[model samples]
Target: MELFARSEKTRVVEEIGGVARLGELVRELGGRRVLLVTDPGIVAAGHVERGEAALRAAGLVVERFADVHENPTTADVARGLAVARDFGPDLLVGFGGGSPIDVAKGVNFRVSCGGEMSDYRGRATATASLLPLVAVPTTAGTGTEVQSFALIADAATHQKMACGDPSAAPKIALLDAELTLTLPPFVTACTGLDAIGHAVESAVTKPRTTVSAHYARAAFEVLAANFPRVVDVPTDLAARAGMLRGAALAGLAIEHSMLGAAHSLANPLTVRHALPHGQAVGTMLPYVVRFNATLEPATRQTYAALARSGGFADAHAPDEQATEALATVLIRFLRLAGLPVDLKPLGLDERALRALAGEAAEQWTAQFNPTPVDPSAFERLLNSAS
Candidate 1:
């Protein structure tokens, strides 16, 4: 049976002093022993300290797990599990970008479900109850805060595993623009682009529904308008809040609609070339948009609608021309963010492209792409991007 389950129950707290409300959330969730999962980078940025302080101020016992790294592997989850086991936490706090949030979910999965990460690589596989989680994002990307999916790679093979379960969704998403104000310019650009990619891809994916499209459209408009401002003026609280809210909405869209080829293509680049996830997706998005719009009428219309939301498409233009205009606009955002527009700049050659294309074809998200993509088709797409 086909299912269309949307996570509208994840309470979102969006305000300038939103992190201050964490104390109330902790009390309401009845959390006595809490586990805070984060990375060293977030700790250095002082966001982790602020989060810990919030929990401590709530008079809750807090345990810290700061061993998570970028593109977290299963080993990272095991490390977190070790801490969780010792802490016996009733609530888990994911305190950073996608990596820490995903790591927190991974640890919770094993702690509650009693298995290795490989046991739950696909969707709706978990039968065990998951611990309540609160997501505090310091970066305005990855929408992991609002989605139930966790991207944990294999420690040995570096192949990413997308684990999803209805129970894995965060119980609350705390969006405080103040936390994002300290983001470096490069991170702001990369994460902002990642949010935009999520909105764009989710709008045209196979599972897109009317509700999902609404969230995606709102995400696209807000991110498109405020991304440059947030990147250029990091201290602009309004722009930062717009990006944070937009990213959360994109995440909600992903929960309902899932993602498509860009994410599938981006994963291989991150695993093979150690490219940043946002950078990989952002660079390849324009090409993917063009590829899908050319081959699918529904996707072309969706792209045209998204372009109209951003004021980039002509209402009277042909679908192909409108979609092309959308792609051109995406390319402009990538260039403005100081990201490469092609794979060659990342030191990838034609030989490497063939291997990456094969991996991209096998990725689970590729099946959800509007247009079917085989290894040969991926090669063509890669060649175009090159």
Candidate 2:
């Protein structure tokens, strides 16, 4: 086994009432002017107002930029950047789901680095310093707060851009499970599955380091045990807290190992159909798992072990049986969450499948899949998901 260099840095402060700490966090960061990035839904949920109050109480000048969309477009980032420039915020507060958090990262990069979104398309792309950022997740999914990357969509093409740099990582992450209680059932389901997809993809990626695998395995265990419980009882704060921690762990996993074809395939659905990122990825996860199972026996065994440890199968089960059991458990969970079990439900046709497959093949994550997945292979996976 080859040993790869590991660079991991995440400051995640989590609790049931972490939002209350926002005031002190801003003071610690010495931020007087702040920009809060979010969406209308988050504002309606009152998280934005709560965050604003915390900042203001801490003696910071707070500006609200709530125009972030479901799948954040480049224009959204540009608009937020314009606000940041106008406010000259000493700090940025990302206060919602992944879309807003991602947009905040992009805004920070653009405002400080002085470039278009396309200029920093790959890893470690920040050429200049960035303002300090704090992330507060209203949703339990996406874990964007713990990552050093941002996914911004192109305005004209709707293609999600994967931009990464150390500068994009938030200086602090505040995870308050209380905020997640207001999430609707469908949103809970989709985001939970997104966390599972992250763990699974991280486990089997070509760049899977020991550190990544550790985080992935822990994330998988947390999600596997708690996601169903949360779906069954949405008001369970303990279950919600578990899911939040799981999502954060998965985020840490992906930050190191990256993701795979599931994410690659999921991006196009958001681009074309406007599907939620979690729902799109959850729909493709089982197929990606089955595809990855065909790799080396050791790889398959590792995945199976992860599955069994996560309670997807009995510990005594054979690797093949365990793998199949894991896939079945995932599919069942998705169905119970009222998510689309097939592409047909999502209104995907053969032509769209081909287009998405071609698009998936070009994604940066596809290259990291343990198995060599080409456009044709992705097409078959799309059909299988359908």
Candidate 3:
């Protein structure tokens, strides 16, 4: 395993109201033509108008592409690409949640590199210089603002693709808690739970490193302590700040170590059931945790420490006991966020488990799981969750 790694750090300007400084930050990139890519919901929230106001105030020529859809497909990327072509932007600003941000990167790939999304599925496939992106995340999930990889699905097949490149990473991440304040309660729960999944999965991946371990542990701590506060009181600015920080750290952790079985498992569920990403991931996380913990003594200890760091386990508990407690707490998180903990409620019975397992075993992140996960193993986990 390669133990050495480095990240192209995104310049983070985090504050209670940092979006107001977005134009100033992007001006540092020296681009006069800016195309802001976002979704209608964020437009409805008025964050796009605020971002436009800031960019225009800084003497930049701004164009808007605000029709992004959830789980952005190549179709969404192509639409944004057509807008990018017509507008000819020197800079791209992703001004919403993960979907919009991923679309911006997908558009960047096409407009800069001149190929389909499949052409850039793996890491560092882009051979052309890409436009700089300023990501202003409106949700405390996916942490797309801090990541180089864009999770775009295929328009026809519905397969989610993880396209990564060193240059595709955001140049600046403007995290404003005020921007996240308008996320409705269910959106809050779904996104926050996804961040929690990022923290948990990255901590114990087979390739996890010292640097990733630092990010994973810190992310888990902050996300664990703050997820409930934001869930209970949507207007709690302090909790939103903590969640934003935690999600960013989780994104960095994912950059270094990647994700694990939980994310892999979630993808198939999301594709098949149209379950929200976070809800699908959160529902199966505890089962994946239990499956991973028992694979090796070292991995068990690692999960135990991660759980203890989040105060979900006793300091002196046995590794297995602590890991069990961790799994239980993960289940508790799903419930706290008003998300489902199993597949039963969605009306999928045991018959649906076999095919889902096959698809899950094929996910890109599945290879990085500490335990070598085969379809049978995934089937077992799915059966357990069901």
Per-model lDDT: 0.88, 0.87, 0.89
Summing lDDT over every window of 10 consecutive residues in candidate 2, give the lowest-scoring window. Answer: 1-10
Query: What's the TM for model 1?
Result: 0.95
Which is the leading candidate under TM-score?
3
Q: Please state every model's RMSD to the true fold in angstroms.
A: 2.8, 2.9, 2.5
Model 1 lDDT per residue over 300-344, tens place = 999988888788887787778878888998888888887788888
RMSD of 2: 2.9
Query: Better model by lDDT, 2 or 3?
Result: 3
Residue 141 lDDT in candidate 1: 94
State which candidate, 1 or 3, has the greater TM-score: 3
Off by over 4 Å in 3: 1-7
